[model samples]
Each structure stands twice: as structure tokens, then as C-alpha cells.
Target chain A: MDEAAIHGILSRLLMAGTLPGSVKLGEHRLAEIFGVSRERIRKVLHRLGHERLLEIVKNRGAFTIEPDLREGRVVYEARRILESGMAAHLADNLTEAQIARLRQHVDAEADALRSGDQPTWLRLSAEFHFLLAEMTENPIVQRQAHELISRTLMLVKRYETTAGSACGCEEHRAIFRALAARERGKAVKAMHSHLSLVETRLRPTICVEEGPSLEEVIAHEIAVYREANGAALMAAG
Target chain B: MDEAAIHGILSRLLMAGTLPGSVKLGEHRLAEIFGVSRERIRKVLHRLGHERLLEIVKNRGAFTIEPDLREGRVVYEARRILESGMAAHLADNLTEAQIARLRQHVDAEADALRSGDQPTWLRLSAEFHFLLAEMTENPIVQRQAHELISRTLMLVKRYETTAGSACGCEEHRAIFRALAARERGKAVKAMHSHLSLVETRLRPTICVEEGPSLEEVIAHEIAVYREANGAALMAAG
Candidate 1:
């Protein structure tokens, strides 16, 4: 029932697009689903509201935020600044263990992409940058980078039409190669171009005229997500 | 009763050194002072604990964090990286209005220093860097800079011994002069040296053999802080 646990669950649901933009959050159902009290759910909702992931109405309830073009650009710009710094640091301080760990993540991303698992591919792609951040050995910068990456992921989930196309496997490999070679300028350049490519690939989805009910939206999104990933929808439950 | 308001109040008290290191927070007293319920105060205290400003125990109440040298160094390092980035960006994007604002803040810092107002001097010194961040027009960088500066302030309060020596007026003037002249290299060098000087000046206090009671400790700290700045204790009340 801690706020962090609830936040992780809610964030996962948001990433899976189970709670589409403007869909109402059913507090009672969420409390039941999480096996926590209504008050605990309220706290999670309030915290998410502060994070700009949800918009809370006075009489009604919280709804998922509809990502806009401005927010998308801002998040991507932040990612570029933070990750470019990480890449530069990693190039200067690249270690065998860190390089091995990053290669492992890149392998996993390739596997997910090969299997056409969009959700897993997206998760691994994001994890690659986080792993780069951890290699820098600065917890403060690592934390800021993680927050910006998560926000950018949320924006991507809202706008992305084709998941596998957003992150090119070769760009990650190019950046890793540059870091392994201790080319600081090349690593920074690769990171910037990689992020720019990801931003370019994100095209906003078409909006539907009629907004569906909360349960219907969640179920439909879950179905589509499961169908795309070939995984059971056990995360939300 | 919101977290933002409570955080602001606690942050100010921490900055003013009215709540010294390891002083146990009186939840009941704060609830009465803020005119809120105990639960609301607990939430704020819990959040502060997460922020490393307070240490919460299962049986014992939360106590203000006794910052260590490691944290002090880490905070200053983060600030240098962030503010140096801000200075470089501002050099490229400096406007007449921005220059005027920067000069105005520098003037305030000089006035505070001349008047021997420790609290105002500390506040303005911190605001000078924050103003530079705002001039970048990048909200994400601005937010990260604010957090790092605030955390650095917390560390400074815990370790700083000299009243008016931590931030020198001439250093601020030098940074302004460099920025006004549009010398990017000089600006970054000035900012980095200013932060380095501040870090070098922070000397930790010696630990006493006997510990004071919670109320006595808070009262004594408050008295010392107020006498140092010629301010009433109205901020807490």
C-alpha cells in the first residue's frame, strides 16, 4: 500500500495504454484491484496528478493526461540534454562490466524486436538509456535522467503509431560502439542523433470522436496490448 | 495541508538553521502551528524523509538529517555541472531584460551583504543561480537546477560556519560582469570558481559530547539563528 508501489503499478498501466487519454480512473475499482484502502488510492491519484500523468476533477475523479505536441518536444529535448551528458561521461569512464551490461540490454532489445513484441521492445529500449546513466556513477544525475526518460516514455506511448520503428537497433549499436572506442565526441553525437531519430518516428495517433467508458477502455486497450505482445494481462490484476 | 506548502515551510526553517541537525520534529507542535491534523503533518514529514531532509524511525519521530561531507560534495558537484550548463546557455541567449534582472539580483546580494543579513544574503546568493537557470528558457533544466541548488543550500546550512563569507559579493559581481560582457568562457569559469569557493568554505562543526533534549535543542537553535539575522521567530508561528 505504499505510494511507490502504487505509483509503479499505475505507471505500468499507463505505459500499456490500459488507461487511455481522458479515461476516468475508478477509485473504488482501483482500490479493490490493488487490495488497498480507498484513502491509499486517493494518495496515489493525487501524487500522479502532481506528476502530470493524471488530471483530477473536483467532483469526478482523475483522468489520464492527453499528451500534446509541446509536451512531446519538451520531454525529448530534456532527454537529449541528459542522455548526451550520460553518453559523454560513459565514453570517458567506460568499464568492462558496464559495457557488458549494456550489450546484454541491447541483445534483449534485439530479441524483443525480432519477436515483434512491441511492449517489451519499448521497455528494453528505454532501459538501455537508464543503464547508460547508471554507468556514470552519479546518483543525482542518474535520477534526473530517469525522471526525464519516464516522462518521455509517457509522451511516446501517447503518440507512437509503430513501436518497433521508434527505436532503431543500429543507432544504439552505433552509440555503444562509439563509447567502447572511447570516442567522446562520437558518442555524444550518436546519442543526440538517436534521440532525434526516436522523436522523428513518433507520429500521433488518430483521435476517436466518442470517448468510451472506463472499463471498456481499459479492457480494449489491454486486449490490444496483449494481442500485440503475446502476453497475459496479469500486470494490472 | 498540501505537501508543497509544508515543504516550503520546512525548507525555509532548514535553510535558516532554525532546525539543526538531528533535532526531532514535533509533529504535534507543527500540526498546531500549521492548524492541520496530525495525519496531514505525518504525510509532509514522510515526504521530507524521502527527500533526505528528515530521518524517520518506526518508534521514534522523524529527526532532521545530519548532512555529511560526502553529501555536501555530491550536491556541490551537481550544482557546478548544472549551473555551468546554465551559464553557457545564457551566454548564447542573453537578453537585455535578463541582464537587467541579473544585475538587480546582484545588487540585492550586495545590499544584503552590506547590511550583514545572513538569511537574506544566503537567499539572494541562491536566487542568483536560479535566475540564470530561468533565463535559459528550458523548464526541465530549470527544475533540475532548482532542486540541486536547494539541496546544496541544505548542506551549506548544516556545514557552513562563517556568517557572511560563504557567498562573497565580489564573486557575484564578477559573474555578472562576465555575463554582461558576453564572455562565455569567463562566465563558465566564474560560475565554477564561485561554487568551488563556496564548497571550500564549508567547514563542519565539532560534535558535542552531550546531547540536548528535543525542545531545548530546537529552542536554542532558533534563538541562535534569529540573533544571527536580526529576525523575529514569526516565520515558524
Candidate 2:
């Protein structure tokens, strides 16, 4: 099996941005947590660093990266290349079961947004796309999409200009409707528009008070929102 | 500036694979050739490994991977996603200058094939797509396109696919023509057809030769391909 423990820790930490940018990750602590040898830990970190998830200096320990605007551009560009095509493929190939799953995904995203579970929303939003790619049945494309998604997450953390909300529930619902109807062209067109909105919402800055990353604020808000709304979160919103 | 040292070495190997996949590389010799520390060599090997250029292993060093049948499928899937969209983008945005450049690229590929300069042909063919992506002036899409191209090259090697001789030069020319007219739909369709040729030629094999992996093959070919092609070698094929 793959080295699940190390990868899981790295993936979660990187996704959550718990390992803040430039914050040196201590080897011993990571080893203790993962219960793996430093060698294995080093291997995984080195791999993640190569993926642009972490920055590893020779002497210094690895730290999460704070991608610049250029990188932000890269992330979006990758999305344009991958997700756009994926949207078409998904629309053309979406099964009834898949449509239900997507509805479920959108529901989760809406739930996260309603509950103010920014992290959950952010995560669910990404997973929504990732899951769509998975349905394409191409591992290579899936890997490429996953890479782009991770990079996008990293970039989102840096700039904090994600689409206006967890994923416009209405848009997801609309796309879902289009897919369910087997209208490939409509689904593809809808996907493009939806992605455009998502991309457009990702403007330049997060905030003036930007005490925390937009991710931090949104994710924490989502959690609070979740606490207040429970099932009513989406309804209340 | 980009470090030409590792890239230079790597490109040589990859281009060489287009002509011939059977090559061997020695580690100590390569370090001496590059005049770098073994550590640097290891890092480069590891990086290429991630890119699937060099199949470096814990004990077996590295080898330039020749894509078997399974890998070829992986490669083609990536092409389907990236190139199809690239063609569409090109069709929508092709300028006169861009069209001319694309023609020149096709010509160069033909010239290399005619001259039996597989390395140059290989580099040019790969760059042609990236150059088209660049014309979009979208570095983000360009970069993602780049990653896909790199992986595709590996697949070509794995499958021992002969992407065909300059016999199909007119096809490339035709695709360029469509791109120039901003026939977005036509261009996308052309790219799909073009990549289909590539996929068709790829020789599928279920065998994974039990020996030094595709990484070391990459190391040697990286060096050799560059030495053979000189300036054209600069393209990150």
C-alpha cells in the first residue's frame, strides 16, 4: 500500500493550511505524529515540495508555500485547461447515479456555506470538481486535475479571492439539472459559465483587515455557520 | 533564469527516445559530464522521476521510461484533454503571426524528419504545441499544457510509438490553417484528429521489462539527445 499516514498528514495539513506559509515543519514532530522514520517523512515532503505544496530549503525544514500571483495565474490557467474539458466530458458521460452524487456534492457545499463552514465549503467545492474528474475514467487526467486543484488551493490561500460563495448553489443545481437531462451541450456551456463565475469571483485581494487568510476566515466562518444552521443553514441562508 | 544544466541534460535524453529507446546511462559519468555534485544529480533525477522522465528507484538508479501499452493509454488520455482544448483556444485566437509560427513549426518537424534528425523533430513537435499554447499569451494554461506534454513524451517512449514520419506534414499544415482562421470549432476538431494519429501509432505492450527503470533511461537519453541537437535541444521536450 502507499505510505498513507505520511501522505494523509501532508495532504490534510496542506489542504487546511495548518502548516502556514514559510512556517518550518520540524522533522521530529512530523515523524512522531506519522510514526514513520525521518527518511520516509523526508521522501514524502520532498515529493510534496516538488509539487509546489511545500518549499524545502537545504538547511531549513520544509514549509508550506505562499504562491505568488503568477502562481495564482498558473492555477487558474490549469483549471481553464482541465476543468473546462472535464465539464464537457462529465456532462456527456454523467450517469443518473453521478447526477445524484453531484447533487449530493452541491448540497454538501451549500450546507458548508450555510453553516459558515468555510473550510468545509472550500474543501467540498474542490472535491466537487475532483469527483467530476474522477468520473471521467482517466487516471492521467485525474492526476493532472488533482495537481491543478492542489495548486489552486495553495493559490487560493495566498490570494483568498475564491468565487463569491461556497459555489453558487443555484449554479450547481442548474448544472446538475442540465446533466440529468443528458443535454451535453447545455451542460458543457453551463460548466463554462459556472467556471467563469468562479474564476471571476477570484479577484485580487481578500480584505483590508486580512488578519487571517481568506481561507482561514471563510473556513472558520463556515464552521460557525454550520453550528448555527445544522440543517437550517442552507434554508436560513 | 531557468537552470539550463539539468534541463539541457534531460531534453537530450527525451529527444533521443523518439529516435531510439535503448540507451544506458552511468551515474558517475553523468555527474562528471554535468560537472555537478552527485547530490545535485540525485535531485535532478528525483525531479525528472516525478515528471516520469526518469524512472529512478531506491537502488537501481534511473532509466528513461519507454511507455508500454498501459502508459500509452495514460498519455493519450492527457492528450485528449489538453490538446483538444488547446486547439479550440488556438482556433478562437490564432493570429497571422501565430499561424505563420505554427506553419514554421510544422515545417521544422518535417525538416527534422527529412534530415533524419529525430532529436530535433522530437523537440520541435513537442514545442509546436507549447508554442501554440504560448500564443494564447496565457502562461497558466501554457504551464499546465507543458506538464501534460512532458508526461505525453514519457508515454510515447513507453509505448515505442512511432508518431509517424513527415508523410503527414499536410495534416499539420491543414490544422494550422484552421487555427489561423479562428475556426475555434474546426481547430478543436483538428487537434482531436491530430492526436488520434499519435495515439494510433503508439505500440501497446503489456510487458514491463524487469530491469533498471525508465528513469535511468531518461538520464542517458537526456544527455545524448541534447548533444545531438544543439540549439533545438533547448526545447524542453
lDDT winner among the candidates?
Answer: 1
The residue pairs that clash in candidate 1, if any, are none
Q: How well is each residue in B7-120 modelled by candidate 1, as lDDT tens digits? A: 666765665544557777878987776667888888788766655567888679888766677878877766665576466556667999889988999999998888888778
Q: What docking class should model 2 receive?
A: acceptable
Query: Please, what are the lDDT tens digits per residue for candidate 2 over residues B151-204?
Result: 666665556445453444666767787888877667766776777777777666
Residue B127 lDDT in model 1? 84
- Stretches of candidate 1 off by over 4 Å are A1-4, A57-60, A107-119, A161-167, A181-186, A209-237, B1-7, B50-52, B58-60, B107-120, B161-197, B207-237
User: lDDT of each prediction vs. the true structure?
Assistant: 0.73, 0.67
Instruction: Give DockQ for candidates 1 onward, in order.
Output: 0.31, 0.39
TM-score of each: 0.77, 0.73
10 residues in a row with least lDDT, candidate 2 chain A: A206-215
Candidate 1 TM-score to native: 0.77
* Model 1: per-residue Cα lDDT at residue A83: 73
What clash count goes with each model? 0, 39
